[model samples]
Target chain A: MDFSSKLLEQAVDEVSQLPGIGKRTALRLVLHLLKQPESQTVQLSEALLNLRKNIKLCENCFNISDTQLCEICANTSRNSEIVCVVEDIRDVMAIENTNQYRGLYHVLGGKISPMDGIGPSQLTIKPLIDKVQAGKVEELIFALSSTLEGDTTNFYIFKQIERLEVKTSTIARGISVGDELEYADEITLGRSITNRIPFENSLKN
Target chain B: MDFSSKLLEQAVDEVSQLPGIGKRTALRLVLHLLKQPESQTVQLSEALLNLRKNIKLCENCFNISDTQLCEICANTSRNSEIVCVVEDIRDVMAIENTNQYRGLYHVLGGKISPMDGIGPSQLTIKPLIDKVQAGKVEELIFALSSTLEGDTTNFYIFKQIERLEVKTSTIARGISVGDELEYADEITLGRSITNRIPFENSLKN
Candidate 1:
């Protein structure tokens, strides 16, 4: 699309570089900003720049943080022995919202996706392995998604620390709490039946 | 959702301020930016700032431009006597893309919408009237949308220049090109039949 102003064109181009946003959408967004007060644009730009310039990763778990350590890793009351391994901070926020998990997290940054040129080395697998080897964690929970990439990342890390004394387990996969049995997928239904928990144990939750 | 970092939260908040972007989508976009090279964020922020600070409106037509006069207005080859009045710069671009009209444009910034607290005074209507009163334009074409606000704005402008010797016309309302007659809405289909053009006139385009 032809732009009358180079500044508008540049702004639209940069906005379209974001994931999921196309050229038309970028133009619409930029035009929206142009219509708003200049203070809105200034605040948005400053917030993005400040975030990029000063955001830090937790020294312990590699989660995004303002300080050297993330809140989860720094909390003393939380269980340090049981560490949940996941894809990124979004998962951390998801689990945290549940108010159920009290253990710390080890953010893998991303899963092992060879199709995307992301191997085990590209993730935070080494730091997690080192943490497990140091005998700080007693149990390591694999809370990654059930996709092929998630399994590959989980298996790769499991192989590295299989000889250690750490207890390893994956999150349970089954029909969601409110979902009906008729709507459940075949593989999930089969697994749910095969790995059915004891009746008394289901009541415990 | 809780963010691990305050910077991340701030960025997400600002991004969600945009139309159609919610908190979850904002977080996803912000996280995507975090994964990318820092330079990407810097460039996006800088581009927005530059556009907001340096972008100008065309002095003649009030279209968004980098200079005092837009490209169309600066070109002497185009017909200055015939002006198509539009709601905003996007309409100007759309009309330019058609390549059918060789006349210049007069961008009204926005239509008069009292529901949105937008009055004619808030738009560039006064300058447009002043231009018409100066005898610079021989014909004024109302190319605004067919919405209520568009009609109100058009009528208001027409009343202001009713005593002038200039000719006033509105863009034809009809079924879109390549659209089937069966699928056309009642109003558009009815209007198309009532205002049907001669076969030879239609063939001319």
Candidate 2:
């Protein structure tokens, strides 16, 4: 759409570059910013720039952090030997929110997606291999999504450290806790049966 | 959710301040930015800041513009006597998209909603009255939204300039073109019937 203001057009253009926002939504957002006090726009712009300029990445886990090590990696109480491998920080946050996991995390930054031109080299797969090869981590949990890219990345990592003594396991996949088995997909229902644990093991959890 | 990184938390907080974005979506957007090259983040930040800093408002109509006068107000071919008064730039864009109107516009910036602490004084209402008082505009079109706030604003503006010689009209509202009559809301259907125009006028479009 043609804009009377070049500034508005440019703002809309840049905002539309984000993942889910389209031109119309970007225009609406920009216009909303314009209606507010100029200080609001300044605060938003400054916040965005400051975060990009000063943000630090954790040296060990490759997670976005304010220091050399992330909060999880820096904490002494959390089990450093048990690391949960994730595709990104969002997964880390999701797992942390559940409060069931008390181990360190290894954020791969992204998964390997050949269709998107992203390879294992583009991610932190090398650092993860190096970490596992050192025999420091006792158990490495693969907590990536169940998509094709996630599977590909997990398989590639598993192959690299197959010789290592570390016990590697992927997160369980089945019908959600409250979901009915009848409505579940065939693959999920079949997998749930094949991977079923003993009644005592289920009761323990 | 507790963030491993303070910078990530700050960015998420700022991004979540946007109209539709919540914490989870904000975190997702921030992580997506981190995955991309740092230059992408810089570009996004700079675009947002530069637009807010350098933008100009049109002198004639108070619409967002890159020059002293907006495109429509500056165009000599368009009818200066016919002015379309709208609530904001989005309305200007919506009407412009139709390619139906050749008139200029006056953007009020917002409707006068007391619940939102918005009053006529907070808007460009005074400037609009001054523009009409100049006796240059022959007709004024009220193209605000069809809401209580919109109607109140329109009525207020109408009362302010009732003594003027200008002809005033509002955009038509009814069941949309090709929309089923049964599904249309009661108020809209009733208004469509009460304000029915000549059958030939409907065919003219």
DockQ measured for candidate 1: 0.89
Global lDDT of each candidate: 0.93, 0.87
Q: Pick the candidate with the highest DockQ.
A: 1
Model 1 Cα lDDT, one tens digit per residue, A1-205: 9999999999999999998999988988998998999999999999999998898999999999998988889999999999999999889989998898999999999999999999988899999999999999999999999999998888999999999999999999999999999999999999999999999998876
Give each model a TM-score: 0.97, 0.95
Give the lowest summed-lDDT range of ten residues in model 2 chain B: B28-37
Docking class of 1: high
Clashing residue pairs in candidate 1 (N, C-alpha, C atoms within 3 angstroms): none
CAPRI verdict (incorrect, acceptable, medium, high) for model 2:
medium
**Residue A17 alpha-carbon offset, candidate 2, angstroms:** 0.3
Question: How well docked is model 2, in DockQ terms?
Answer: 0.71
Candidate 1, B1-205: lDDT as tens digits:
7888889999999999999899998998999988899999999999999999998999999999999999999999999999999988789889999899999899998899999999999999999999998999999999999999999999999999999989999999999989999999999999999999999998877
Question: Clash number for model 2?
Answer: 0
- Give me the runs in candidate 1 sitting further than 4 Å from their true place: none
